[model samples]
Target: MDLKRLNYFITIVNNKSYSKAAEKLHISQPSLSNAVKKLEHEVGAPLLERSTRKFALTDAGELLYTRATIMLSQMDIMNKEMKEVIVGGKGEVVLGIIDSLKTWLPKLIYNYKQSYPAMVFKLFDVLSVEHVKQTLQTYKSHAIITNQLIYEEDIDSIPLYKERLVAVLPQEHPLSKKTTLSLADLEQESFIISTEGFQTRIDIINAFKEEQLKLNIQFEIDRFETAVSLVRNHLGVTIVSENYVMEPIDKTVIRRPIDHPFLERTVYLAYMKNRHLPVAIQQFLQSVEEHFSTNKPL
Candidate 1:
């Protein structure tokens, strides 16, 4: 079947309604139906079960849909590569990174450009482990730089560096007097831990549990800035990766290193293990490995 019909079929399946797919595709309903009909005719088997209210894909249709999705993705990539070649545009290194890497990323890109001038960088502030995993899987980012571990089988991870996790406390907080703080020291302090789904939340929870300390969580946040903001206001204490507080330490909050092995996080460079990466992206991955190998952010 032609790409157009396969696209129409996929759209219909995604929308779960022929009329909705037609509207989305900006085509007449009958025209969309005719395209599906032709596709089924070409396949010599009914692709959809007409008896169901919500159309169901037949076995043959399921196989075709799976294959077509991959084929279309490859075709789209081919078109993008062709256009880039025509315009003398090298592919971009699309990276999803945690917030801490914000300052040095541009420098990394600038330095990489010294070797490969044509390639460009696209950076996304992907913080949570779940968000970064989805970003890589969806091809929204070619790779990810993060500290959290990704247990997914399809993603390949390169260990970068271990960053110390430190506590952000209000200057006036009792524990702020200490040079290094333990979970025991902050047991009674109002805690501002990360939200439930984040790996940081899990790590912090387990760290407190291991110390047999009660985690008095007063605030749950997704952003480190929010944690810092709350800590600055003396609302609660929060822990963060040291890289996040490296520069621009304001007077309101005090950062003290957490004195536990579990408090340290290892930064990682992660990418889809099985996907065919573009040449520039492949080069970028290599360059990233080399860059981190020499310059550990820790």
Candidate 2:
């Protein structure tokens, strides 16, 4: 019931033994035990099963442990946010980003730091569309930059910019001679595309389907570099965001713009619609909007 007792209960569950929890908490075993007992009495549930030698949680104990951990984590986040407001110094931003956005995401993050020198950033690579949505939904990330269009009603999305998709082909492929390529043109070519859950793969498929073309997908890859490697080895071709093909781009593969309207991907900055964002995070999002609004190069 009380924060102190709940914390004590969580510590005991985490350490798995009274002696270890006591040591970690810098308290006597009896004191730790008393705290947990008080918590059990307050919650009206037997938290631990004493029948187990290594110690185990009762069904109720497991539930309490899960809830307490999440509660404590939110409390900590609130405390940090409050400190940032009063002290104007320390704060952290947890962000989820798709791989392709790395082309300019690092710079955007760096620019944010210039305004708030003490800002801490936790960057997570979220490539698959489903994974990115889950990251935002679960509050794992405050905001995300993704290549897919999320249709979730509880998520708010901001359009960043549209980047053209390009065809990556083997150096000697006859289609490489063209300045631009269409899905119909590459229908007969072996394809090395992203995995099934990836937005890139879905977009690629839709683009081809629109033209009534069938893709001969020979391989599935996660990274754009991997696609280049496969194409270089004469395995198959791939379609990906333009910047995904990093510079110092090798000669063994060639990139030509894809001509389909559906192939142009719009990057999005998405976040939980109802979540309260910390001020630092709000400013970071603002900077992104301003940059793209002015047509400044990312």
Q: Which candidate leads the pack in TM-score?
A: 1
Rate residue 26 of model 2 by lDDT.
94
Clashing pairs in 1: none
Model 2 lDDT, full chain set: 0.83
- Model 2 backbone overlap count: 0
Model 1: residues >4 Å from true position, as ranges? 81-91, 115-119, 152-154, 274-283, 295-298
Residue by residue across 100-214, what tens digits does model 2's lDDT show?
7767878887778998988888887777778878788666778888887788998988898988888888889999778987778899988889887888888889888888889
lDDT on C-alpha atoms for all candidate structures: 0.83, 0.83
lDDT, candidate 2, residue 4? 85
Local accuracy of candidate 1 as per-residue lDDT tens digits, 1-298: 6999999999999999988999999999999999989999999999999987867999999999999999998787666556655544366767888767755667777777887798777777766778878887777788898877889999998998777788998888777778988889889888998887777777788898898888998999878889999999889889988888988779898899888888877878999888776666676678778877898553
